[model samples]
Target: MNVVEMLQEEKVVAVLRRLPSETFLDVVRALAEGGVRAIEVTMDAPDGAELIRRTREVLGDRVLLGAGTVFTREQMQAAKEAGATFFVSPHLDSDLMHAAREWGVPMVPGVLTPTEVAAALRLGAEAVKIFPGSLVGPGYLRDLRGPFKDLKAMVTGGVNEDNARAFLDAGAVAVGVGSSLFPRTDLEARDFASITKRAERLVRAVRG
Candidate 1:
């Protein structure tokens, strides 16, 4: 399946930021073992592009890989070349969205208001990610749907097992979970088991 189809199927995007290259595969393994099928490696992470490439080689088509924190058209193209199946950003950028469309990569651009969401959709984005989702809560999603009923919104930031279900129940297509799902301290301790447990909990929350 393509990235868009995969996102629709999984309904969750596990964002990995600040993860060491050495532990990247281990993290992917833990999440995959816990039934998580989509993962995003942020460009801010060390060797993020290389990690994405390696992950594609290691997991093949079993997992959907994406690049996050992409800020420019060049970065989007590079990510695609590095085997990123999708693109994500913390803010909506028309240029980046256009590049993603040109590459045929599923784009999930961040938006904080109805105007931005409309702009993103106009650019052909498959979905819009609501950043700082904690602040707005699921209620914001419900409100946005009122104006853009056709928009597919994913809530990120401060999304944890405690409130993941709330976001989904509120009508979000998916949620981009970061530190709450992939804690850096725990991973550094080589606690792959803990990561697996967290992933499992998140899976349950999203499913619920």
Candidate 2:
């Protein structure tokens, strides 16, 4: 399936922002064990390209691998070659949009306003992500959908099991979750089971 179809099916993108390069595969395995199929390794992570390559190598088709925090063409190209099939950016950028289109990979660009959302769709985004979504809450997405009924919306930032359903109910096709689903304390303690459990809970929340 395509990224959009897969995303709508999975309903959650487990985002990793600061995962150590050494624990990449194990961490992903934990998530997958809990039934998460969409994983986004952000560019801010150390050796982002290598992590994307290794994530695909280890997980293969069991997961739909994605790249995040990408804002440039070079970053998008490298991640694409590393087997990334989708991407997310903190903001909309022309260069990044062009690269994803060129590679035939889906990109969900971040937007905070109707103008940005419209522009992102105009630029060919598979979907537009509402970043720092907690700032405006689910009502904002509901409002955005009022006028852009057909536009796909993905909610990101400050997302947790508690609030994910609100966003999904508000018209979000999917939600991007970070530290709440994969806490630093668990990772530091090497408690992948906690990550697995949390991922399962989050998956249920998003899917509900």
Candidate 3:
């Protein structure tokens, strides 16, 4: 399936930021073990391009690999070249979105307002990520859906097991979880088991 179809099927996107280059594969394995079928490797991570290439090689088709925190057309191209099937940005950038579309890669551009969402759709974005989702809460998502019922939105930031389902119920097509699902302290301590457990909990929350 294509990137957007894969994301819709998975219903959850596990976002990794600043993962240790050495342990990136191990982390991917742990997340996969916990039933996370999609992963986003943020550009901020060390050697992100090489990491994405390696991740694509290692994971193969078992997971849908995506690049996140993309802010420029160059970054988007790098990600696409590195074998990322999808591109996710923290904001709506016309250049970035258009590049992804032209390359036939799914793009999820971040937006905080109706105007931005409309602009992203107009630019041919596959989906729009509602960033810093914690600040606006599910109530904001519900309100947005009222007017843009066909809009595909993925809630990101400050999302945890407790609120994951709420966002989906609030009309989010999927949820992007970061530190809450992959805590830095836990990862630094090499607590893969804890991360696995947290991911399982989130899976249950979203599935329910």
Candidate 4:
């Protein structure tokens, strides 16, 4: 399936940011077992490109692996080489959007206002990421749909099991869960089981 279809089917993208490289795959495995079909490893993570490569090698095509927090062409190139099928950014950048189009990689750039959302679409982005979803809440997403009814957005930042379905109901195709899906404490303690349970709850919440 295409990236957008993958996102629509999963309804959740487990955002991994600066996680320990050693156990990253283990975490991904747990998430998959819990029914998370889409995973995004932030570009800011240590050796993020290598992490994507390893994930593809180990997990194969069982999950939709993407690169998040992308900003520069170099990062995009590295991620593409590492087998990332799609990219996401926390903010909109015209150049980045253009690059993604030229390289034929699906990119979702973050936007919060009508202007940013319009700009992202004009710049050729197929989708947009509504960042800091907690700040504006699902109501804001509903409001955006009023003007951009066809908007394909993934709400990220501060997304959790309680609000995942709310965002989808508000017009988001999917939601990106970070700490809620992969809490620092759990990762530090190697609590993969807890992470898996969180993933299960989140997936159920969204799918319900």
What's the count of clashing pairs in each model shown? 0, 0, 0, 0
lDDT of 3 by residue, 76-109 (tens): 7788889898888899888787788788888999
> How far in Å is the alpha carbon of 132 misplaced in model 2?
1.0
The global C-alpha lDDT for each of the candidates, from Candidate 1 onward, is 0.84, 0.88, 0.86, 0.91
Count: clashes, candidate 3: 0
Q: Give the TM-score comparing model 1 with the true structure, all chains together.
A: 0.94
> Where is model 3 more than 4 Å wrong at Cα?
none
Q: Model 4 — TM-score against the truth?
A: 0.97
| Number of the top-ranking candidate, with TM-score as the measure | 4
TM-score for each prediction?
0.94, 0.96, 0.95, 0.97
Instruction: Find the candidate with the highest lDDT and give its number.
Output: 4
Give the alpha carbon lDDT tens digit for every residue of 53-126 in model 1: 98899888887888999997877777788899888899988878777778778888888988888888888887
lDDT of 2 by residue, 84-147 (tens): 9889999999888887887788889999999999899889887889999999999999999999
What local lDDT score does residue 145 receive in model 1, on the 0 to 100 scale? 90
Model 2's alpha-carbon lDDT is 0.88
The predicted structure with the larger lDDT, 3 or 4, is 4
Clashing pairs in 3: none
